[model samples]
Target chain A: MNRDRRQLVLMLMPYLVGLVVLVLLPAAATMAMAFTETDLIATSRFLGAANFVELTTDPAVQAAVGNSLSYLMFSVPLRLVIAVGLALLLHRRARGSGTARAAVLLPGAVPELAYGLMWLWLLNPIQGPVNQFLLLGGEGGRTALGTLPPQWLTDPEDARAGIVLMSLFTIGETFVIVLTARLALPPEAYELAELEGARAGQVLRRVTLPLLAPVLAVLVLRDTLMSLQASFVPTLVVTNGGPPPYATTYLSLVLYQDAFEYLRYGYAAAVAALMLGLTAVAVLIQWRLLRRWASHGIVGAGAQRPGN
Target chain B: MSWHDPGRRRRAYGAVAVTALFGSPLLLLLAGSLREPGQPPVVAPPLIPEDPGFAAYHQAITHGDLVRAAANSMIVAAVGVPLSLLVASLAGFALTQLPRRLASAVIGLSVLAMMVPATALLLPRFVLFRTLHLTDTLVPLIAPALIATSPLYPLIYYLAFRAIPADSYDLCRLADLTPMQTWRRMALPQVQPVTAGLAALTFALTWSNLLDPLVYLYDRATFTLPLALRALAAMDPHNQPVFLAGAVLTTLPTLLVIGVAQRRFMHSYGPEGAP
Candidate 1:
């Protein structure tokens, strides 16, 4: 009713417009598309439940869902441990941390397409430098991608591992955020622990780990959601979601295949909508679990100065 | 702190060994790219090639689509970053100044936006752009970026603005400046470091994006750098050397940008309240 209130509404208008157009509208369209059977062609009919039925009954969809679960199982813990270890190493600035950080971060900057291609070659069953070095040109020498490379891009177990390995290279964005959280911790806390004759491990346990827990939780939540929609580049470069007809098919890959490959716009939209729903659930779970950490990391910086 | 300390030295050596191990993949990439087909494969001796030639780089450069893609990428980034900065700064300033409950809601929504992967948005965005007659053009590519609608840049700017002391805004108000003027004169200067960091990242993202143009654009003439590399890869799957070379060329500008941005981040993290 007053000037401040009026001013607030006026200022918020632009952002509100953006939200409607950019976020809300597209999301709504996806939901609507999920319910139909239009192939991006002339006429479309409402085929509610039919698309949902197929999505659930489809064996390829089941395998993809299973592989995605396996991927989360392997990738999350692997990345968390590796990321924390690397962060700790860089945190101490032990000779070459800067350069190490930069190098590690370089992979994150690389597009998925590039990284996928690199892996496609690196994991190549024959003559890949990785397999070659491992085998040392003996009778055991064979292309890892061909002989022992696991069906990473194609087989269920291997495809999951492949996804994890591909993702391993791009931990930089998370590493950076975690580094920010680590650097933000009060050095005096570590200083005091040292003065008290604490061992390095003790200091890490007592001081660093608790301080970093919040950031790590935030990183996990963010990455999990991002991982759900992971497709396009990886699919294109490696398996193309093939071999057993549909071993490595993720929801996004399925959507792409349906839309671009099969011209099944209605089916693609349905898949897209499901993926969006999963993403939403992931975000909700993250918020419920990590809201305290997110708030403290962002807003409680000054208030938590006692640790200083 | 002393180099004479055996413990410190041991830790330093430990760090180096770990880094060398972790960093080997990138090195392996370089070495593998350089090894000529049919040559005896040796992982040791020199990580550098015996001849140390740039044949792969030469081929990558001469690829017809690459140069044009680079130009297109530059244009896309050059236009995208500033537009995002302006809109994000405005929205961030407004959001930060709002009432506590309202601000939390906005922040929550934005965080939710960030949590949803960008890939999920692609399909609807493509259809929407097509309906609007903007799909084949660069307009759809740049439009979402023009608003502070993107989660990544806006989120960074929001955090940066929030980090600045609120009293500065109060001081501006006391000086008789309007909110817009206050943002431009006071808040904008403070957030410059954050903007610069975001600028580098935005540029890198724009340059390396492979999917958007590949799907949206109808012609090779509009291809971005990553798409150019993808085209090359599709053309020759056997030439791992050429693929690696394209990857290198694609990543060079990104490395430079990250190099410049890291200094700002380091400075920001130096001797401060983590808050």
Candidate 2:
């Protein structure tokens, strides 16, 4: 038993060392530095709560937080809807299903920088295909095509929309997860529903959806957490956080700029803390919501007694 | 299952529509890369370039120094992916053998660790690396992989290892195999699919990573492919074709990996069942 314990610790040593040096140490340092003022070159001085206080009133930081929240609000639901929708559509084995599934997964495999760049080109106002297609009505109508295409990267509104659209294609991971969950659903419930002469929509509402609710809830929480950080990349690559006014600047961008660009490590740490707190709150709220959902017996009752 | 069902037909159409809408950007990218340079740029470049050639690709590679940056990315992946897998898997396996209470605590800590976003760690990690004099080198970029900085991979490995029956360990004891030997002979073989999945996932992630490389490496020589692509984008913003070519080059290897391991990748996400 002792030998086994020793061996286990030996095996775990590398990760334990890593956990301390890499994750815990940095996290501790970040928490500590959140209360002090330092620029790495200068002598550090404690500034308790000043950073957080400034964050409350700072216009740029406020704009960034707002932008991030808007992104989370819009992107998470859109991504989940698209993911679940695609998973349902592709879960069955039908003609062309395999090819369609591969196409959906392709974007997720592309590098983020590459993916952002591709969107940058596609959304370009003057010479992009998206605008061109919008312009050419192709016998349906020529009326709306005459108007100028939206300046996706330049205009602030379109830029945010562009980011959201870019996000939709990378639903490969969520799609696979939801697909697995959907596929794992018992077929007996569906057959029973069919025997009762239930329509497809009724079956979906009464049986399929309730069964997949847990997975969908988890996906929502996961996507929400991811949206907070993942928005940083596209904003950085595509918009550089802006066409002035810092329109696309997100909280992650703010933290990055504060630390790396402005050399205000202390302020950045505080911002980082806030971002972490926000994520924790979001996750906790989702957990509570899931628990409440469970308590209501929406999922468990349906799962245990399907199609009653 | 029901070919004659109208709902199935609608779903099939919906699937095709989603694919077309989502897949058009990539098709456009491919077409744009093949467009002839110096053609008077139009309002919406043609889907099929009138005079297609390899000129844009040639220009991107030569001017962007893509070869060097790609080499740097290769170095990072070659070292980082395996190290991450080994460390995470070892930690995962160890968690199974430790007392249940300690294992849960460790698992909880790792889960909490995972919750801390990478952005939150960026500034402090930068400071830590600066203090260690490891900034501007590839070391900072590669070092995170050693610990499997994100707990997701380790958790995956833990769940995979946990699915193995406890009787395997008893059998190892009956055979007088050391725990290490037991892991090698029994557990490792059983978890090959998980290992492959994790390794591929790690490789693709490391290969595509831009933020870490951007924060850590400053010099052109140390730049990864993503950074190199960013540099190329900045240098020639007007030349969309060249930019697309560079983007294509950056995307190819990852696409190839996914295409080859596509089945295994999907299987990895399937329901975990006891063996």
Candidate 3:
């Protein structure tokens, strides 16, 4: 290497070491410990896929996987759609637009613990503004239209929906990224749509959505990966994994409780391994779905542009 | 809003409505915190307390050890964010300067590391820190600074630095500046927006990080703001007002910093998207 290249390497050394020590080594340990039985105190003995075998039959693990996937099913796509919608709606200059942007970011700015606590208060069955709004014109915990209030704490499906609802408002980061991307689009494209006298719905469906597809695809994958672990604090705080039968148990919470609470470090390592596997599967599924869409969307958008 | 046509008029309505919907939670937080401590969740309690007071905030501050926790959090953010920014910028600038084969390898490793689920690191990192006898100290909490809080940061920096016109690099080389010098004097200033954004993000992440402190901190004095709030949340269910006060205290600093920084870097993406 040349002298200058060596200097650059020197600068890279610290972060590289940090990556190896903090992330990679622990990752490898998780892989290795998945086959062992230890609790950070005992000498681990290799049990050779026994943890995996147990994991296959572990009902808690299965429920957690289901809960996590169900959350992703609802949250990831909804967050993206709402983020895109908010970006499109408020990205343009208007009165209260700046505050509107901050409002979207507000929930996300709060710490996870605080945010979870806020949701805990907000999802309170009787006094929460959510239920209060629902119960406006009626009494007995029923809405004006007589629908039952969502029991965010006790009911299994309602707990799941509550978690999903909590996840919805924190689309701030996604909203910002989408807003930036929205504002950055070549205005000429919009001008062309205007010259073509395209209606708002058509312009949105064709021009905006297709053009934003690439960024949205990347965000979808990112959000998918994050949502796998994002429910840890909220689930722990709000529902504490449910009214019964582990309704809202997520992988991160499961992993934490197993390792820390139950002192099953090795088993938790197994759970961690399970989480990694699920993440891979989730990403693969999303890639398959979005890869087809991104390519087609981009090509279609380009063709729809005036020059093309 | 008053002058623009139907589109702007509609946008104004939408903006106001969205703000109301999105902003209600925080508003509720303020209202709830103003209530008397230990008030039960009554069906149809007034949205604004009839007799709002500072009692909850006072109880939260005195009872929750929040002042101490806030100081610890400030310390962590102070130490962690700059270190993270430095490590990330250096590594990112280095990536842009490294030979192509080496750069690609490093970039690939970063992405792979970034892809590893954070939960998977919990047990092993805990054990690692325990083995080093660093578990109870604030060091493990700040150790994430070494990774720039997230592996993605360096790559973000790399993208920003690489966007600088090649002639800037050429100019540096013509001046015979060392890579570090060029990175410090040239590359750094050019990517101010990225740096500002990343700093806000890093500080927020470091400040709000609960997982690390949850695993590592046992002592109340050592707890960061989020962990302290978690402790406060464990109180009697009726004491909701105190915890809400705690939440508000926890969120204020992060909100102000990001709010201030967002106006600077977030609104403009210069040159690329102009009409």
Candidate 4:
């Protein structure tokens, strides 16, 4: 028994060491630095709550927080909807479904910088195909109205939309999860719905959607947390956080800029702390919402109960 | 569900449409990169370049330092992916052996670690590494894999191990195999597909990682492909063909990996009929 214990400890030692050096200690330092003032080059001085107080009034920080929230508000739901829609579309073994799935997954496999760069080119106002297709009708002829293409990266709202659109393409992982969930539904339930003369839409609305709610809830929470962090790369690479006015600057980018660009490590740490709190709050809210839904028999509860 | 079966022909057409719509950007990237460099910009870029050549590809490789940055990315992925897989799998196996409460606590902490936005760790990690004089080196970039900092990989490994039947371990014990030996001989063989999938995912993650390398490495020689691509984008915004070429080059390895491991990737998520 002792030998087994020793072997187990030996096996776990690398991870334990890593946990201490990489996660626990750094996280502690980040928390401590949140309450101090330092430029990274200079000696640090403790300033209780000073960074947080300033963050409340800082215009850039405010804009960043707002932008990040807006990004999440738009991107998360759009991504989930697209993911679920595609999963439903490709759930069956239709001809060429394998190829279709691969196409959907391809963008996600691309590096972030490359993906952003591709979007940057595709959304170019003048010569991009997206605009070109919009200008020309489906028959490859110009539209009668001569509509002008929107400047995607230059305009703030359009830039935000572009980021959201870029996000929509990377739904491969979520698509897989939802697809698996859809496939896991007991076939007998569908057969029973059919035997009762239920229509396809009715079956979906009653059975499929309810069965999927639990997975959807989890996916939403994961996407929300990811949106808070993942937006940084595309915004940085594609929009560089703006055509001025810092339109696309997200909280992660703000934290990054504060630490690396401006060298204000303390202020960045405070921003990081706030970002962490926001993530925790988001998770908690989702947990509560899921519990309510589950109790109301809108999700997993329905999965346990038989057909009405 | 039967009532909504759009006819087979229509479903096929719809699938084609979806693929085309989703694939156009990458297709455009490929087409744009082949365009002759000096050609005047068109009002709407053509699906195929009028005069395609290897000039942009040549310029991207020769002028952009793409080869060097790609080497750096390869070095990172090559070292990081295997190290992460080994560490995560071992940690996961050990967790499975721990008492129930301790295992749950460790798993909970791991989940919490996953929830923490990676951006939050940048400054403190930088401070720690700088104090250790490890900044500007690849050590900071690779060190996190030692603990599987993302937590997801270890969780995946744990789930994979959990799927093994208890009788298999009992049989191994009856054969006089120690736990370590049993893991090496029994569990490792059963989880080959998971290992392959995890290795591919880890490779893709490390190769495409931008923020960590951007924050840690200062030297141009040590820049990863993404950082190099960023520099290329900034240096000449009008040189679209060159930029596209660099993007294509950077994405090729990941695309290939995904295409090759596509089957194993699907299986790693869940069992054949289970989510």
Candidate 5:
């Protein structure tokens, strides 16, 4: 090999080894391990399809799957819309926009564990300021709207909603990307929109959305995967898979419990296999939905240019 | 852009609303931490305590063993983040040098790797570490650094490095610089904003990571900050203030790191007054 080839290999060796060892090997091993009954202590026994068969009948698995899908359904769209809205609103300098921008990003800067603990207090349902503020207006345990406050920790539905609520504030990464995309667009289009005296809504509909579709498409795909697995921390820390019967027990929690708590490695590997399938299906669905938009987003990649 | 104009005034109001709505949780954390110790979970307590105190923070640090856990967290992040950046930046620069097809294939593989969620790999990693007898040690926690914490970092670096003009590489060749030399001296210096932003994120993520520590570690001595915080809550479920204090301590460093990088990062988005 030439010097260039040797140099390239030398540089690429670490990443290639890392990708294979950390990702590819584990992925393939998960499939194989799904067939065996091993708990890291005993001799491995090939269970054939038994682990997968049991997965089909487990109510816990069923509930975990349902919770994950519901979490994904609600959180992904809400996060996307909010992130894009914030990016569009605060992308430019104006009075107090920097504060708004900082507000948008600061929650994301928070560590997940810290953020989870913060929500544990904020959504405490009893002593939590959220419910307390809601209850302040009424005589009894009701709010001024003649409704009761949400039981964010105890009630099943509210426990799920609280997780999604915690998720909404941490869209800093998404906001930054969308803001850069907005900035990177050819200024001539916006200049033309201004020359034509386009209303803000009109410009958004006709000019901005189409240009940003590509970036949004990618965010949708990435956020879909993120929303699915993002539940591990919250469910573990705040909810503990509770308001029980696995209401907030997402797939990650299920996999975590099966492998780590129960020491059922093979069964957890099967759950992991199912998660991989879910991820593929989710990404494929979004890809088909947004194929046109994603195709052209990478060329310029929202980088800063010389001429605005 | 002045708030005196009607349109701008409406937006300023909008800004205030989001800043209040989304930013209130941190305030709640702060308030809960400041309450006097031994107080019951109060109903509709005032936002500020009549007499705020740091007794909860004191309890959290001593009884919760937070100082040791925090030191462990610092050790992991300090060692792990730089290693991650090194591997990611090297492969990213190498991508710029590789033939286009090979580079695209590698990039495609990297994207696929990113899509595989960390949860999916938990058991295999556990088995791998156990087989190597690295469990209960800090190696499992730090091993992810070799993968750049996520496969996404290399791709981000690839995009940033590719944005540089071809003439710069030509200049490097003319100056008799090797690939590694050009990468360190020329390419790295040009993309300080991206490096700073990515480093801040990597640090924050590493510091906050709870899952690996939860799975691999059982000894209290090896627990990182998040695990220690969880243990604090579990130890005294009724004492919410102590755990809240622990949460506050975890957030400050991550926020400070991001604040240091935010100005350069914000400038990279565009010069001020883009409109």
Candidate 6:
């Protein structure tokens, strides 16, 4: 028994070192730094929630927080709706549908930075084809990146809209996840619905949607946390978080600027901790709500294992 | 044959039209890159310009720091992918082998790390790397893989490993294989599909990542393709064709990689499994 314990401890040694050096230490450092005020050159003085107080009252932080929340409110449901609709529409095994699905998903595989840059040019207000095409319809002469030209990165209203729209193109990841779940649905359930002479939409609502709800929730929670990161490249390139008071500043970008650019290590650490707290709360809620929906029965049928 | 039937023919025509319409955007994007700026934007022009010069490609090769960045990226990826695979497989295997309590904690931590957006790690990681003197080198970028802290690859490998049965481990042990031998001769073969999937994913993540290198590397010459492309975009946002050209160059490798990997992916991740 002693030998077994030793062996087990030995096995865990690497993980422990890794956890301490990579995760725990950083977490501890960030937590401690949150209470202090230090630039790179000097020792930090304990500030005792002064930073948090400032964070609460600062209009920039407030706008950032509001923008993030509003972004979540809009993007999550919109992505869920569009992803499910697209998955349902394209999940068929018809000729060339798989290829079509692959093509649509190609956008997701492209690097986020590359895709962001591509869209930056493609959505340019004056020169971009998107706006040019929009103008052809004579829709009040508003360009796609004009004062409110679906400005995916600038105007506050349009920034939220743009983030959501940009997310729409990357639905390949969510689409594939949902597609697997949709395919895994027992054919018998659909067969019964078909026998009942149910319409497609009815079967989708009653059978497909209900069964896939768990995966949908997972996707929503996952994307919400992800978009909370706000994809730095897009925001950085598209808006530069600009125009005034930095409306598009995500928690990560703010942290990055604080730590690296300004060398306010402590402030950056505080931002990191806040972001961590936010994700933790969101994740906890998701875990509690999503436990029931996780029953997708693993994909491959095989010998049973001890722990999932 | 369907011409005699209006409804069938109309549906067929509609399918064709939709395919063409949907396909046109991608095609136009590709076609637009090839067109010079002086040409009228509306007209469908040559697939290759009249000059058909390799100017963009040449510029990308000669003037751009693409080769070095590509080298750095490859080095990072080559080292990082295997490191991630090994760490994930080890933790995954041990989690299955260990007592219930330890396993749960391990799994919990892994899942928690996976769920946290990688952006959250940037500040902490930059600070950590700075202290270690690993910042600015490939180590900071690559070493994250060794710990399975790469938010993307670790989750992918964990899912893949989970799909494998515990019996595979026992089978290798019973065959008198050493742990290393077992990994090579048995477990590796069984998880080939997942390995391929994770490999592609690791490549995608490494190749496309702009944040880490941007933070760590100060010199423009050290920039990866994505970083270089971003730099190019910043230099001249108004030069539309130049941006497209850079985008295409940046996109080419991954596109080719996906084309090749898609077959393996299709086989491994059946139409039924998650990508």
Q: For candidate 1, what is the total of clashing residue pairs?
A: 8
CAPRI-style class, candidate 4: medium
Report the Cα lDDT for residue B52, model 6: 42
DockQ for each of the predicted structures, in order?
A: 0.38, 0.56, 0.63, 0.61, 0.64, 0.33
Per DockQ, the best of the predicted structures is: 5
Chain A TM-score per candidate? 0.83, 0.93, 0.94, 0.93, 0.93, 0.83
How high is the lDDT of residue A308 in model 1?
A: 37
Residue B155 lDDT in candidate 2: 76
Q: In candidate 5, what are the lDDT values of residues B1-275, reduced to their tens digit?
A: 23224667677878888788778878878988998877876776787778889999999999889999999999999899999999889999999898999999999999898878787788788879988999888889888887888889988999889989999999998998888888999999998998998999899889999989988999999999999998998898878889889899989999898888887787776574455
TM-score of predicted chain B, candidate 4: 0.91
Q: Estimate TM-scores for all models.
A: 0.87, 0.93, 0.95, 0.94, 0.95, 0.85
Model 6 spans with C-alpha error above 4 angstroms: A1-16, A139-154, A287-308, B1-29, B37-54, B60-63, B115-117, B149-159, B165-170, B176-180, B269-275
On the 0 to 100 scale, the lDDT of residue B78 in model 1 is 76
Candidate lDDT scores, in order, read 0.69, 0.83, 0.86, 0.83, 0.85, 0.64
Candidate 4 residue-wise lDDT, A34-85, digit = tens: 9999897679999999999999998778988899899889889998988888
B1-275 per-residue lDDT for model 3 (tens digits): 11225777788889888889888999998898899987656766888999999899999988888999999998888888999999999999999888789989988898788778887898888888888889878899889989989989999999889889999999989999999889989999988878888998898899889889999999888988998888887865568889999889998999899988887686555224324
Better of 2 and 3 by lDDT: 3
Q: Write down the TM-score of model 3's second chain.
A: 0.94
User: What lDDT does candidate 6 reach at residue B46?
Assistant: 41
For model 2 chain B, where is the 10-residue window of minimal lDDT? B266-275
